[model samples]
Target: MARGCDGSEAGARLRGIYRTKQSPIFLPDFLRSRIHVSVCALICVVGGWPSGTEERVIQPVSNEEIISLALDEIDGERRAEVAGRIAASPDASRTLAAVTIAVQTMRADDSISPPGEVVQRVLGLMRSGVRVRTSLMDVAGQVAEQVREFLCTLVRDTQSEPALAGFRGTTESRHLSFECEIAEIDVQVSRGEGEARRTIRGQVASLTDDTVGRIAWRSTLTGAAEREIAADESGVFVLECPVGVYELSARVGGSVVRIPPISVA
Candidate 1:
C-alpha cells in the first residue's frame, strides 16, 4: 500500500481537480464528492482563496515622502515597500532620482566654512547695546547710501613699489588695494598662460569699527567676463575668468563696492 501524496503530489492532484471541473465527461457521484471535499480542505490549509476585495491597494507616494525616502529617513521593511512603489511609478522614480541628486549636491556644499568668531562677537555686542546711538533719520540715510553703487578708490598697487636697481623682472601676479568709507578690498590676480583664464584671490575688511563684524560678502565679476562667488567667513574669495576687462563688485552688508574696470592679459 502506498503512503499519502506529498506537497508536489498534492499540487498535481489539485491541478487535476481543476481540469476535472472543466471537463464535460460524466463522473460517478462518489468520485465528484471526494474531489469537492479535497479542494475545500486544500483551501483551508492555504488560508482560503483570495477574495475580490482582498486585492492589494497601491497608494500614490507624495513628493515629501519621496524626498524623505531619498534622504534615507525610511528604513527596513518600509524602505523596501516604498522602493517597490517608486519602481512601479515612472514619475515617482524620476522625482526620487532628482531629489537624491540635489541632496548629494547640498552635502557637497556643506564643506564650506561657517561664519567666523568675529561675526559672533558682533552679534554679542549688538545684543549688549554697545552700538552707536543714531537717530531714525540718520539710520534711514545710511541704509539708503548702502544700497547705492559707489566707486572704490584704488589706494595702492604693485607698480607703486620702487624698482630694484632701476629694473624689475616681469612677474605673473598683480596686487591691488582699493578703499571706500565702508570697507577695504585687497586683490591679487595671477596671470595664466596665453589665452588661459586668470585666478583672482581677494579679501574684504571693514573700514569702520562699527562694521568690523560684517564680514559676510559676495564678489562678482561682470562685463567682458562673468563669475560670482561667496566669500568665506574671513571675507576671502577666489574666482577665475578668461582674459578680459571686467568690473569687480563686492557686496558688503547692503553696500555695493564697485572697482574700476580691470584688464587681465
Candidate 2:
C-alpha cells in the first residue's frame, strides 16, 4: 500500500476494522443504534439520542452515491456505512438533501416509521405535505392550491375511468371530453331481481349543473356494492357511493332523495 502523509493503514486489518468496529471514526453516533434507517428517523429522540441537534449534520458528500446508499433497503452495517458517508464531510451544501431524504423514504416505503427527532420529523411532514421554498405565505398557499388542482385532475381521472369503462377510456390522457347526458335524479330497485337501478334521468332541466354530463356518473364508482348519494337537478356531480348498488337516501341541494337500492350487477 502506498502510504500517505496522513498515515493511511492498509490491507486486511483495515477492511476488517472498518466493517466490524463498533465505533468507526467516521460513523455518526446517531446512526450507531443499528436501527433501521426508517425506524431510526422515526424513533430518534432529541436529547437522549446519540447525536444532538447541532451534531445532526448530514453533509459534504458531494457525490449522490451516499444518499442513494443511505436510502437503500439494506440494514445493519451496510446502512451504517451509507449514513456515515453522508455525514462524513463538513462542507457539503446541497439544499435539497434533507427534503430529498424524506421524499426518498416515503417513495421507498409507504408505512415507513419516523425517527422521532429532526430527520423523522421532516419525514412525517413530507409524507402528508409538500416541501415549498416560497417565503411568502400567500405564494405558498397558491402553490399548494395549484398542486391540489393538478392532483385532483389525477385523482378524478383515476376514480372516474374504472367507474366509466363502458362510458369511455380517457383515463391516461391529459385531456378528455365527452358529451354530457341530460338525465333526471332518481333511484330504482328490484329485490326480486336482486338488482338495483339508479337512473340519472328525469327532469333534466331542473337538475342541470356545470358538471352535468362533463362527468360521467354521480356515484363514487365503487364495486357493485350499495352506495348512497344525491343527484343534482341535471344529475351531474361527484358520487359518494360506488357503482351499480343504489343507496337509500342521497342529499341533494340539502334535501334527501330516497330510493330503493339500484343494482347494476
Candidate 3:
C-alpha cells in the first residue's frame, strides 16, 4: 500500500518535480517522464503555466580546450558539440584560427637535434639526479651551452710552410697547432698516396701532466662523430678522414677540450 499525498505535501512535491525539469542537471528518460506528469498535474491545479521557458546558455570554450579539440583529444559526442559551437560562433572560429597559425609558425622555425654526445651527457646528469630546465626558452639556452662547452677558443695557429711558394714537393704536408686552456693540439694534414681522402694525425698534451685518453672527430659536412680513437700514453692519435672541415675533441683527465675547426682542403 502507498501513502496518499496531503494538500501542502502534494504542492511541495509538484514544485520539486518542476525544478528538476527546469534544472541543468541531466536525468534519465523514465525519471523525466514521471516528473513531467507531476508538473502537468500541478499546472492544472494552479490553472497556469510557469512564468517563462528556461534558456540553455552555452559557456565559452577556453584556448586550451580549443587546442585539445584541434589535437583530436575531445572525441565522439563532445567533439561534435564543441565543433558545432566553433562553427556557429565567429569568435570561436577566430580563436581556433589564431591557435592554428601560432602552432604552424612555431613549427616553421628552424630546429636541429643536439649532438649524440650532448644527449648522452644530459641523460647521465638526469640519471644522477641533476635537475634540468624543461621550458622552451631553456631548451635554446641548454643547446647553446652544449655547443659552447664543446667549442674551445683558438689561442694560436701556426702553419709550417707557405702554400703559394710550394717550397717542399707536390706531396708536401702542412702542420697546424692550437692552444686551449686544457691542452695544446698539434695536427698534420697531408694527401695520401693514390688515395682520394687526406690523412690527419694529431696529438693532445697538457702542461700539468694530464694524459689525453680519448680523441673524437666530427665532420661538419656529414655531421658524423661515430668513431672515437684512443690516444697513446704520450697523448698521440691519428685518423684518416675525408677532405672537409672537422671539429676535434679530446678528453683529458676530468675535462673535455675541443680544438677549433680545421679544414683539410
Report, for every candidate in turn, its global Cα lDDT versus the true structure: 0.58, 0.32, 0.60
Off by over 4 Å in 3: 1-171, 193-195
Worst 10 residues of 3 by lDDT: 128-137
- Once fitted onto the true fold, the runs of candidate 1 whose alpha carbons sit more than 4 angstroms away are 1-146, 160-162, 193-195, 209-226
Per residue, candidate 2 scores C-alpha lDDT tens digits across 1-265 of 2231122222222322333333243444565334333333333232123334333232234334444554454578746655665465443224236647776777888576555554543333322212111111123245433321111111121223455556564332221211112223432211222133222322212233423221122221232222223445455333332223322322223222232223333
Best by lDDT: 3
Model 1 is weakest, by summed lDDT over 10 consecutive residues, at 128-137
- The TM-score values for the models, in the order shown, are 0.38, 0.18, 0.40
Model 2 global lDDT (CA atoms, 0 to 1): 0.32
Higher-ranked by lDDT: 1 or 3: 3
Candidate 1 local lDDT, 29-140, one digit each (tens): 6676677567656655665543562222344566656887999998997788678878988999999999999989988885756468545533443322111112111333
Model 2 stretches astray by more than 4 angstroms: 1-60, 73-82, 88-265
195 in model 3: Cα distance from truth in Å? 4.1
lDDT (10s digit) by residue, model 3, range 70-161: 66688987688677757777987888888788877887979889999767644443222111111111333545334222335655444543
